[model samples]
Target: MDHIVIGTAGHVDHGKTTLIKVMTGIETDTTVEEKTRGLSINLGFAYMDLPSGKRAGIVDVPGHEKFIKNMMAGLSGIHLILLVIDAGEGVMPQTKEHIDILQMLGIKKYIIVLTKVNTVDEELVELVVEDIQEQLEGTLLEEAPIYKVDSLSGTGINELISKIDEESQKIERSNSLVSPRMHIDRVFSVKGFGTIVTGTLIEGTLHVNDELIIFPKELRTKIRNIQVHEKNVNEASAGMRVALNLANVHVNDLSRGDTLASSGSVQKTWMIDVKAALLPHAENPINLWDRLRLYIGTREVLCRAVPIGVERLEPGEEAFLQLRLEEEIAAKKGDKYILRSYSPMHVIGGGVILDTLPTKHRRFNEHTIETLKTREKGSTSELIADFMNRKEDLLTSMEETASYLGMPQTEVIEYMGEMVKKNQLIKVHQLYMSSLKYEKLKKDITAILDRYHKSFRLRTGITKEELRSRVASNVKSKDFDKLLQLLADEKVIKNHETISLSEFTVTYNKYQLKDKEDIEQKLKKAGFTPPSELELIGDNKERKELIDSLTGKTIVRLDSETVMFKDYYEEAVQKVINFIKQNGKMTLAEFRDMTGSSRKYSMIILECLDKNKITKRVENFRLLY
Candidate 1:
């Protein structure tokens, strides 16, 4: 069944509650305070079965000036408005304010209702209708149908009901395939249910035992039961007014304006980019950095608006703005929001969210403004590409993209596959990066290696750790390794223990070459007993560089004061292995005698062989494994 919410908007004592009571046969106002004061202080709900066999949810919003915040909360999921105006008093102050709010909130469908018709004369009724028509000129409700009804006497009630049923049939149901999102408007502890939260499901579906996250606090809970229209249900979909009994959360932890959503489906952000317009009836021009109250979904947060490329926003002007919120909120692209002044608290302007998570932008940055404009009007693929491009240094996964875009993972996977096939995105392992970012990283890697080669002429290449730190520190280790391997496969770079450009090779000057040859010959002739540092170019920086280069190439070993040539080290290793294979094991003293060297040299060679895993030491004897 298609579920739609019709909300009441008008001034206090305009008979909104009475009209709903007579129409639905359910009294919305249940609180003692409301009955005693004869005014609503919070949102009250009821259900009306239309003549078309469709059920519509009724949200009766408080119309008093002090409770407008509560009214704003109830307006988030409304599909149509029942704007009430008392025929005796036409449009009052709160009535005009409510109209302004409805305009700002982007509610275009409504039915003008003139209540208390029996209390006014026929001429007064016609005059009031004329006054309402004039007030609605150039507004969303300009062409809305007008009906004068006396709820106390049941006059014109049947015609109003038929009209509402006709309008309800025209509204399309929300898609259930999108991730579920519900902004909590009421939270309480039921006698036997423990904790329950009620709201209108905006999208997707919620089932019993479904895990959900309360955002901004990220509290995890499961649905113990689901209820719609005071009856139990196995599952509920988008556009339904639902009450969920939560399993693991307490009533004290929940509050009005908190959002319940599918895990990882939405993100809480402190900054957003918007396309806003100041209302023509605004009393004051909105200056840059002006603090205002931002309302989206059921959330109301304090924020400062920084107008793009302008000093002050004159009344009736549209501009791009960056809103820095005082608290975090979970929102998505295309979500509507309303801004009210901080002091007098009247609706000033409203807009759609262009980017939910955005970096701080300069006031007059043309590129930023252009990008936001493109995102606002872009296609799904374009928006995904823009999201990837913004995360330049990090690889975005398909799951992450789904969450950021408020899309399902399966759909995101399909889009990503298409993007990869078109070469618009590069898939490295399971992570994704825009083609532009991949190309830029490739260039950066080459440049880093080129600089490293120039700075360290004696070194073979930079270590893998060093290269990653310089070029791809933000990338995951596995993803970074895969990227490097991919580069190596393309022959664009070489990778081993170190990474270097495929075209790069170590080169030496004439003097350095001569010194390297000298050192090699000396070590080669020394056999198993190599000379100490003091015996060969002691404390010389040039000779030290040569030693480091040789070690890097694995041509020599610099162990403390001992320097062993690679050839001799291999010889010693073979001897020990042969001795152990023949005798099953060899002792340190026996190895010393066999190599014809002192204990110091024998121990050093034995330790080197052990380090290389050529032999394992058991007690005082060494055994080959």
Candidate 2:
């Protein structure tokens, strides 16, 4: 059966509680204090079955001014509202306040109910109806039907039930794909049960044994049992008043403002960005950085409202704002919140959240304001695109993006796949980058290689580490490697131990050619006992540069003080092979004698042969491998 929540809203002694009892045949007021005083001080829950067989959960909220917070707690997850008004008194202060709150909370469906109609004359009842119609002229209830009913006598009750059934058929059930969110309005302990918390399931579905986290505290617990409308159920979907018997959670640890949600679905944040509007009946203009009480999803927190791009927000004016909260709250984009004055404790303004997790923004920053505007008004894909574009060169993971946007990771991955297919985003090693940023990185890499080629014309290329240090040092090593491979595949650059422009090649000038020749001759004449690099260069900067160029090109091999030309090194290898073949195994002294070189040169040559795997030292002798 489809489940819908109908919340009562009105003034003190307006018969909201009494009206609910007559209609549902279930007494909502169960607290001793409420029963003794004949006034509800906390939220009450009951359910009724309509003639059409639809189950409707009823939330009877306290109407006294001091218990407004308690009333606000019951307002979350409501699909339909029953605005109860006293026929004898017409509209009162709390009545108007409740209307303002309902509107601010984004409630669209409602039916105005004039209770205690039998206490007033027919003429007075008609006048009260006219007054209600006038007050609802510009609100969501302007076209709503107003019914007169006496709760005690059940007068006009059947007509009201029929209307409710008709309206319930039109209201769509909440989407089960959204993450499950239940705001705890009441937390208490039953004799046999561990800890029981009751609230309306606003979204998704909760099943037995489901692990959930209570926000702000982030206490982890599991659902031991589930009850909907006072009956055991294996699962409860959105729009049902549910009492969850929780395991590993103490009643003392649970609070009314706490929200139970699927793990990783909600996050606690101390700051949020929103598109806010001050109510027309606000008592004072909201200046920049004004402290206020923020109410959202049954949570009340103290926060400061900072108007974006303006000094103050006048009554009824809408603008972007950043709320700096004094405590963390679990909130998300599109969640509606009410703002009340800190001292006067009256509803002043409210708005929908644009960003649940946001960095501290500077007031009047044009870019920040423009970004917020896009978030407020853009489509989902557009918002994701903007988020990626803002990241620029930094690649964002899907998890990070999902957390930032307050969406599920699976949803974010789906969107990212679409973006990648459209070429609007680039995916490298599971990291995402905007197309613009990818192009910029490619360009920067090309420029860096071009500069390196120009500076070292006599060398092959720069080392990969050096290239990375110069160009993409901030990029992750794995991601940078993937990017380099991509560039190599595109023939934009060449990747080896070193990176260089694809078309780049080392060229030797006349001076460099002469120096290279001179160095080759010196190493060749010295044979295996070549002069040390310092001795060969003799402080000649040009010679040193030439030596470095030759070594970089693999034209010269240097091992400590010994240097060997490539061709000569090949010849030495051949000689060693010949000696080993002829003698089977040769001692180091015998090798030195055969090489016709000094002990130092012979030792270097033997070491090089050993390193190249040409020969192995077997104690007193060397053997060719």
Task: Name the top TM-score candidate.
Answer: 1
* Best candidate, lDDT: 1
What is the C-alpha local distance difference test score of candidate 2?
0.85
Query: Model 2 off-target regions past 4 Å?
Result: 389-418, 428-431, 436-484, 490-625
Give the per-residue lDDT digits (tens) of candidate 2, residues 215-326.
Answer: 8899999999999887999999988899999999899998888999877666588998998889988989888778899999888999988888888889989988899999
RMSD of 1: 5.5
Q: Write the per-residue lDDT of candidate 1 for residues 1-625, one digit (tens) a residue.
A: 4678899999999999999999999998899999999998999999989998888999999999999999999987788999999999999989988888898778878999999999989999999999999988988999999999999999989999999999988877675777889999999998988999999998888999999899889999999999999899999998899999998999999899999998767768999999998988799988888999999989899999898878888889998899999999988877889889999888888988888879998888889878987887877788888988886455888877876776767888899999999999889888898888888888999999889888877776788878888878888778889888978998989886578889887677999889888888898887777887567666567787577567646465646666777877777888888888888999999988887777888888888778767787899999985
Give the root-mean-square deviation of each candidate in angstroms.
5.5, 7.0
* Model 1, residue pairs in steric clash: none
Q: Between which residue pairs do clashes occur in model 2?
A: none
Q: Give candidate 1 regions above 4 Å deviation.
A: 406-418, 455-460, 463-466, 489-491, 508-625
What global local distance difference test value does model 1 have?
Answer: 0.87
Model 1, residue 382: C-alpha shift (Å): 3.8
